[model samples]
Target: MKVEFFFDVGSPASYLAWTQLPKICAAKGAELVFRPMLLGAIFQATGNASPAAVPVKGRHSGIDLGRFAKRYGVPLVMNPHFPVNTLQLMRAVTGVQMHQPERFEHLLKTLFDALWIDALNLNEPALIGRTLIRAGFSIDEILALANSPDVKAQLRSTTDEALERGVFGAPTCFVGDQMFFGQDRLDFVEEALA
Candidate 1:
């Protein structure tokens, strides 16, 4: 089965899904494709809102995410800088994908871990630069790609394509015509793959 995962760095649920889905796919002998999409754009196009927008759901999600983190044995924390505008971050993802495909995995892992595991405040460019540097990434190169017009267009086009795919949120996984939303749905995803 072919698995496509649509993600946004700013979403904690996306990070959780990232941690778990790869292992699931590997065990099932399925190929997992990581797709970086802009969650803000999806929400705008689909009239969806993050769980944070709702007080009860927001609190519950935090607890639920923690449970998943423990179950997966991966470090996770809600970023103190909640609501980080990941426009630049997502652009960097697209840029790496377009310019340096080899670095995509490392870049994705580094940024996802920074945003969710370390719970760093990635809202500031300066902090991002430092974080990238620590992750052994070229700060200049990534920033340049992130700021370029082509990269911006790539992110836009990817977001547009995601909207067309019935995706209204992050961590959406597809197995052919079957679409599963949320990290909690990995069991069903595994079933689909089988």
Candidate 2:
């Protein structure tokens, strides 16, 4: 079996899912395909806003996410810069995944750790450059690829495909045609893999 993980590095929930899905797929002897999509585009296309758009729901969601983080024994510090614009970040991700598949997982880990675990404000270009440099990535190469027309088009196509797959949010997992919407629904994903 294979799990198509449609994700954006900007979403904390997607970071949580990223921490768990590898283990889940490993135990199930399943392949985990990383489908990097633009979450902002997904929201705009679907007319679905982040839970943070609603103050009460955002607070509740934060608490719930904390519970999950504790349950998973993983660190998740909500970025003070919540809702960071991730257009270039996602494009860089797509570019890396396309040009250097081997470094793809490393890049994901570095970015996720920066945003969720370290609580870095990745929305700032200088900070992002420093973070990537610290992670041993060449910022110049990343920038060149991220700004390339091919990378931009590929990210857009992936986001469009995600929309067609009924994906309205990040951390969406597909076990065959079974669409699981949140990191919290990973149990269902495991069952589907079984």
Candidate 3:
């Protein structure tokens, strides 16, 4: 079986999913395909805004995220910079996944850890550069790839494909055609995998 994980690194829920999916897939003997898409574009196209857009929902979401993190025995600190513009970040991810497939998992771990575990303000370019370097990535190479037209188009295409598949948010997974939204729905995902 295969689990198509449609994700955006900017979403905390996505981070939570990332932490658990590998183990779930491993136990199920399933392949986990990472589909990196632009969340901002997904939101714009679907008229769906981040939970943070609504104050009450945002606060409750944060608390719920904490509860899940605890349940998963994983660390999650909400970034002070709640909504970092991730256009370039997503592009970088797509670029790496396309051009340097070997480094894809490392890049995901680095960025997710920075934003969710370490609570780094990745909105700042310098900070992003430092984080990439600390994670053994080449900033220049990443920048060149991220700026390439192909990478931009791939991200767009992936986001459009996600919308067409009825995905309006991040961390969506598919077991065959069974679309499961949210990390909280992972139990359904596991059942579908079975």
RMSD of each: 1.1, 0.6, 0.7
Q: Write the per-residue lDDT of candidate 3 for residues 1-194, one digit (tens) a residue.
A: 99999999999999999999999999999999999998898899899999999999999999999999999999999988989999999999999999999999999999999999899999999999999999999999999999999999999999999999999999899999999999999999899988
Q: For candidate 1, lDDT tens digit of each residue in 1-194?
A: 77999999999989989888878999999999878889999999899999988989998999999999999888998987898999999999999999999999899999988888788899988999999999899988998999999999988987898889899998899999899999899999999988
Q: Give the whole-model CA lDDT for all candidates, comma-separated.
A: 0.91, 0.96, 0.96
Select the stronger candidate by lDDT from 1 and 3: 3
- Which stretch of 10 consecutive residues in model 3 shows the poorest summed lDDT? 37-46
Q: Mind sharing the TM-score for model 2?
A: 0.99
After superposing candidate 2 on the true structure, give the runs of residues whose Cα lies further than 4 Å from its correct spot.
Answer: none
- Estimate, for each residue in 1-194, the C-alpha lDDT of model 2 and write its tens digit: 99999999999999999999999999999999999999999999999999999999999999999999999999999888989999999999999999999999999999999999999998899999999999999999999989999999999999999999999999899999999999999999999998
Cα miss at 142, model 2 (Å)? 0.4
Model 3 accuracy (lDDT, Cα): 0.96
